[model samples]
Target: MAVKVKKIERKKMPFLERIYIFYIIAGMARTFRHFIRNLLNTKNIEFLEYPEQKPEDITPRYRGLHRLTKYESGELKCVACDMCATACPAKCIYIEACEVEGSKEKAPKVFNIDLLECVFCGLCVEACPKDAIRMDSGIFTKVEGKREDFISDINELSSRKRGDF
Candidate 1:
């Protein structure tokens, strides 16, 4: 196939446009304004020197890690539906589902959230027909020795009260 090429033209910027110092000063002013506001209002601070202070709680709507759930009867709530795993665009969720006693549908007996790969997009929780898997856990991740170490149990993930979840 033959292709035709067009000439590229470059334009020169005027004095003010070429000298980016104006932009720099504007940025500095904005940054200082934010800093001043944050200094006065503790809520506006963006930087966190972690381990020095208690971490701020994420909103109940904010999704962090993945979690499995159980019915009030102590039966697995996941029904092995695979909705969460299927909805995961990152493909980070791994669920090994097995049948529960006297149940027709399967449930995830071994569900693992790969913290290394999880994008934490919250799609998994939204896709679940059952309110089984949730990211509403305000627990920001703690340190783990390995990637596998970050793989926490449901109890660890759901350390807070039912209201917290």
Candidate 2:
């Protein structure tokens, strides 16, 4: 038995289409129409006066920044299982676990997340079994001068409180 292979050939475009001037002119005409329409009717303009005005509301589901939750007793909710760190695909999460002073559960002594490397996949939040981590603070990570500023420490994460948004 012999296998037969067919070679696929692409059709060549015409000279005018190859030059693309017609398409460019059509696009320019469309842009000019829009410009003229917008100029004639200023009401068609759609833009916010940012800095002076902000968007009304941020959706509850918006994943902004990471924050560590706490129990009512002021103790961290995290058991320091390192599940979140382990689950992070970016390897941006770092944790140093230590036994809690009075409790049998382990707690993170040094928890830091490098936002620069973080892809914001929300995997860390999902992997947290104790409901310890969340990305609901509604605070967008800011531009920092130094790379070191991007690494959020345990205190910064744990200091976030509910309703802070």
Say which candidate scores most in TM-score: 2
Worst 10 residues of 1 by lDDT: 156-165
Instruction: Assess candidate 1 and give its lDDT.
Output: 0.72
Clashes of 1: 0
Model 2 agreement with the true structure over 1-165: per-residue lDDT tens digits = 999999999999999999999989999999999999999999979887753465567667778779999888988898889999899999999999999777788999999999999998999999999999999876764668998999999999998655333
Cα TM-score per model: 0.65, 0.77
- All candidates' lDDT scores? 0.72, 0.87
Once fitted onto the true fold, the runs of candidate 2 whose alpha carbons sit more than 4 angstroms away are 19-21, 24-52, 163-165
- List candidate 1 stretches off by more than 4 Å: 1-5, 9-57, 153-165
